[model samples]
Target: MYTEENTARLLPDVAVHAQPHLVGELDWVGMDGIEVPVRFDAGDGDVQRASARVGAFVNLRRPDKRGIHMSRLYLQVEQALSTQTLSTATLRDLLRGFLDSHKDLSDRACLSIRFEHLVRRPALRSANSGWRSYPVTIEASMIGEELLLEFGTEIVYSSTCPASAALSRQLIQDQFAKDFDAGKAVEHAAVLAWLGSEKGIVATPHAQRSVARLRVRPAEGAAFNLIDLIDVTEQALGTPVQTAVKREDEQAFALANGGNLMFCEDAARRIQKALDADKALSDFHIRVEHQESLHPHDAVAYASKGVEGGYAGKGCA
Candidate 1:
């Protein structure tokens, strides 16, 4: 099955032929959902490897050309992404390499990589910790000499309904008034015993697991530190979901939720304010959704940096 004559034979390439099936330039033509390996620095002195789904595309500018070389794009992605640490500069080079392979047929190139980034999270007030996964997507596009980049991530937290909290407080106040007389001096031990009883706290506020989806455009020449972003987001929200918890940690989490009662609108505004104060991010879009425990429907809110020619908060895309 192997011979010198077979090796010398030419392989047919149909993509090189000029044909006129439909004579119009297409916006983008390439591949999506390509399986690839991505390596990146986690900023903790270790390079993490992630299984990613990659999308590579280049504009089809030549009307008469049958199709661009697709295998070239795949090979380049497999080669560069598997070995190199992912960064803005790396993505810029990869996009430029796409255009270089299709010299005459394409002028603009774009790429998208989606993966789950894992991080170790400690308990609220315990020594225990566990791994948590965050969904992340990085997008890059290059046209001529200019490159545009954006990254999106999702954070899960706990949200307690503010209105429900107020109603519960009112019920507790009414119960306290019924138990103690205003004109009489109440003993401290009796009050503590009543507060510890089940009938004393009549109602509890409703809380639900909520998610915050964010897209950000980093400032030029800034290091793309995802952990920093996550830290800031969790700090602003104040009630990040826990991984491992002891009794004390659970109590601490309850205290945090009690202190940080929020509506979906409140969560969005908090994130917006925090992001605005971060100089590393030039523009950002925030979308928060509270999966309501009381109602079947979810409550949501959206916000964006009000910068001209930036994210308009129109859609999550």
Candidate 2:
């Protein structure tokens, strides 16, 4: 029978501890897509467990070391993340553990976890609610005593084209003028009947499902308030997609869309203004995409807090 002593004699660490043929330092060396169980505070003191895909990395400072302890990284992620609620402090400690394991082999470490955050949303003008899942990514890195944390989430909502609304209003006016002759005194009943008819409202503004990808660098000592950020963004947009709806709720949603006509630029600017006012977020990047109903292409806009050396105001991050 195979025993521990015999197994140890049979397998050696030659390959793992071997020196690299090309002796040059790598910027980062580690593994990704490690399956891990994580928990986070989802507002109101509620702790939620989620399945997360983790990426862990540490700098390869030693030119002679060919490889890192991949198993060590995986174990650290599994043990640390599974036991603690994911937060800035937990992430910082996790990254520090990474560097500690690699010791002289690395000076910096990074960790990322991606998962779906589920929230219960109440229907507009209804006594019902449903669950919505938001894709969220939390990333942390520790480099030379400086720890950075970034939170990213995707928010799905509705966007109505402003230009399309204007054109639709013009068409409706033209239809109304055709029904009633100029300088003719129309009866209230006739006008109301006509307004109720399909021919009366001949056009509608094109609205489509839109997505907002937001990445924010929280201020120092700020807690992970994921739901708060989501609520702020959805409130600013004012047209978040509904989970459950009745006719009344549908009508209310339509009214909201009518009142909140926006282009991609408008969505981005609205989110920018809201994030700028948030004291918890020191820097942020916003990318809003309107999946156009009138055209095959999507309309996109990008914005940032204009923080120096932060977000750079370019991509969605």
Q: All candidates' TM-scores?
A: 0.94, 0.95
**Residue 41, candidate 1: alpha-carbon lDDT:** 68
Candidate lDDT scores, in order, read 0.92, 0.90
Report how far residue 274 has shifted in candidate 2, in Å: 0.7
> Tens digit of lDDT per residue, candidate 2, span 109-183?
998899998899999999999999989899899997799989999999998889999999999999999989989
List where candidate 2 sits over 4 angstroms from the true fold. Answer: 1-10, 15-20, 314-317
Cα TM-score of candidate 2: 0.95
Pairs that clash in candidate 2: none
Deviation from native of the Cα of residue 61 in model 1, angstroms: 1.1
* lDDT tens per residue, model 1, 238-292: 9999999899999999999999999999999999999999999999999899999
Error of 2 at 235 (Å): 0.7
